[model samples]
Structures are given as structure tokens and as C-alpha cells.
Target: MPDLAAVADLEARLGRPLTPDEQARAGALLADASALVRDFTRQEITPVTGDTLVLRPVGVLLRLPQRPVTAVTSVSAVGPTGSVLGALSGWSWDGRDKVDLSCVSPAGSWPLSWTGPLPDTYQVIYDHGRATVPPGIVAVVCAMVLRTLLSPSMTAGMVAERIGAYNYQLQQGTGAAGASVVMTSADEKALARYGPRRFGTIALEAG
Candidate 1:
């Protein structure tokens, strides 16, 4: 995956051109920043087509791990022995990543009732993700990289020492190498919508 932000984006934020050293380091900073954001959000946040997701369905309500699912091409059930049992029907995309097995199938029957097994695995082939990266996500990535790029070498904490009126001070908001790359609480809030679903997995249905 490419870095979410670019050198141009960093230059734009800084309102000045990067020196040669800064330019050389920007790539690494951007890559680290993008990885951190993706890690925090647990999303690709990029468009993909014909993506496949496999699930050992825990319940009638199946949630796809990706976002903005545009289409479902097929669903198959595989037995515990690893043979694909057959094609599954009646599952419908719920506009996002969820699939409802309880829906009426084209054959006019609920699809949740499997003929032969406990712990059947489902393979879903689908199209999902955004056509373009969201602006907010890009902004967040830029901010994180910029912070690291511009930050002085120091950690964000308190330091105090008093010896015969000697005084020395190191400012806050600075940290060890790579410390600025962490996703802060604000970043989490900004990315909550893009993060993984919070719903608890229900026990598998065996009807």
C-alpha cells in the first residue's frame, strides 16, 4: 500500500519546500505515519474490487470485515472436512459489510438452515471499499507525518532539577524517535467510522 500522504502534501502543510535532508526523510516518515493510521483503523481505506472474505459464520448476522461493500458475487459453504459443500443463496448485502443469512432465498426459503453440519465455513466474493480515499483520513495522515517531520528531539513529559540555581529546560510535545508517529486519542476519534466494527460476534447458529 502506498503512503496515505505525499511529499507534496507535507510541503503544502509546511507552506515551504523541504530541504534535501527533509525530503529524503519524508518518505520514511510518510510510510510510518500511514502504517500507523492503518493499524489504528484496521482498514485499507482504499478502493478494491472483487475482494474475497472468508468467514466461519458465528451467527445469522454476518458482518464483512471491509467497508462499503458494493456487491456480492457469490457465497459458498465449505464443510469441516474442507470440501466446498455447495453454493449458498439468500444472503444479501446490508448496504455495508453485513450479510443476513436469515433473509428469504430466491428459492423462497430461509438460508440459515444448512443441511449437514456444524462449523461450516463460508467464502464470500465481493466488491468493496471507497472509490477514493476520504479527505479526513488523508488529513490525519498528513498531520501525523508533519508532526514527526517538524518535531524537535525530546520526549513529551516533565523534567525538573534544581541545583544551586542552575536551570535547564527541555520543552514538551517532543519525544524520542518515532514517538510522534503514534495515533493519538484525537486520531482514534477521527478514524472511528473507518475502524473495525464494534459488534460482538454472536454464537453460531446450527438450525
Candidate 2:
């Protein structure tokens, strides 16, 4: 579903080749991992282009709705009834975390004097995000899925002995996991290595 990682990428992380069956299962796992990463970071992994906006807040940063924003088509504000308020001239996009709204045009700006928050007031039509998924994120996904695939029993909670005794314990086994939802320390390590997108007062471009 999400093309964050390739089958070859998954195979590389697995340190082996994937069977025909594994390939099908790997697709599901990769899709799950992609969604988890986006939710975890509160960042959009998919690329999208449309009109979006942000309201004025205490901080100078106005985080775009969808990010990392690839391009800003236009920046403007609208009233509750969708009336044109004003446009920011000296504003900037960090390309990741936020758009620097340093310049506020017109004193009677919406929310500055009216209701509704900034994230709702302003309108920015732009192409947001990238198609090239981060390698770190890909690695993280593969590692997580690999763990599940390598431990189907552990993930399935099938630790019971084959006998009626019902005794169970974790043991090594093999199978491609349908999905990997379990977060492990390794996942955190991978994310830390990649690091989160930093946000700050950025210039008009190159952020």
C-alpha cells in the first residue's frame, strides 16, 4: 500500500532472499510499518499537493497541515465565510516541521481579532511531502517485520506445547509475519538514528 520500502530492501535487511510467499506477506507488513512510522512521528510519509493553512499562534512557526511541504503554491488567509483576509509576503517554509509566519499582514487578521484557530484560518495551496521514503524508516520497517517473520510462534502466542500439558515457551521458528505491530527497542534505535525532522525559524526556501 505504502511504497516506503522495496522488496529488495526488505530482502537486504533480512540478509537473505524472500520466497514467493514471503514477498506477498512482506507487502502487508511494509504497509503497516509505513502507517506506524507516520503516526509515531506525526508526519505524512505520502506525497500530496493541495490547499492547506495554519492560524497564528504564539510561536513564529506555522506547521503546515501536510509535510514535509515540497512546494507552496500560494499563501493567503480567509474569513469564516471564506472571505480573503490578506496574504503573507515575507513568510517562509522550513520544508519540514513548519512554515515561519514572521510577517503578519494587516492588523485585523482573522483569529488575531476573530474566532477559529490559525490551523483553520489560513489557506496555503501547496505540494507537500516527498516520494522518496527515508532509508532509515525503510530499515526500521524491515527490521520489525523480519523479527516477526523470524518468530511467528512468539508473535502468534502459540507457545503451548503440542501436548495437552499446555506448557509454552519462546523458541526459534520461521515464517513471514503477516504484520509487525510490536514495537521493539530496535525500532526506537532505528528511529533515533534517523532522527526527527527539526523545526525552526527558516528562510523562504532550502529548509
Q: Estimate each model's TM-score.
A: 0.73, 0.63
lDDT against the true structure, per candidate, is: 0.67, 0.60
lDDT of 1 at 126: 78
Q: Which stretches of candidate 1 lie over 4 Å from their true place?
A: 103-115, 154-171, 174-180, 201-207
Judging by lDDT against the true structure, name the best candidate: 1
**Tens digit per residue, CA lDDT, model 2, 8-74:** 8877866889988777677777777777777676566667666454444337665554556678766
Off by over 4 Å in 2: 59-61, 65-67, 81-120, 154-180, 192-207
- Which residue pairs collide in model 1, if any? 154-174, 154-175, 155-175
Worst 10 residues of 1 by lDDT: 153-162
Q: What is candidate 2's CA lDDT for residue 10?
A: 75
lDDT of 1: 0.67
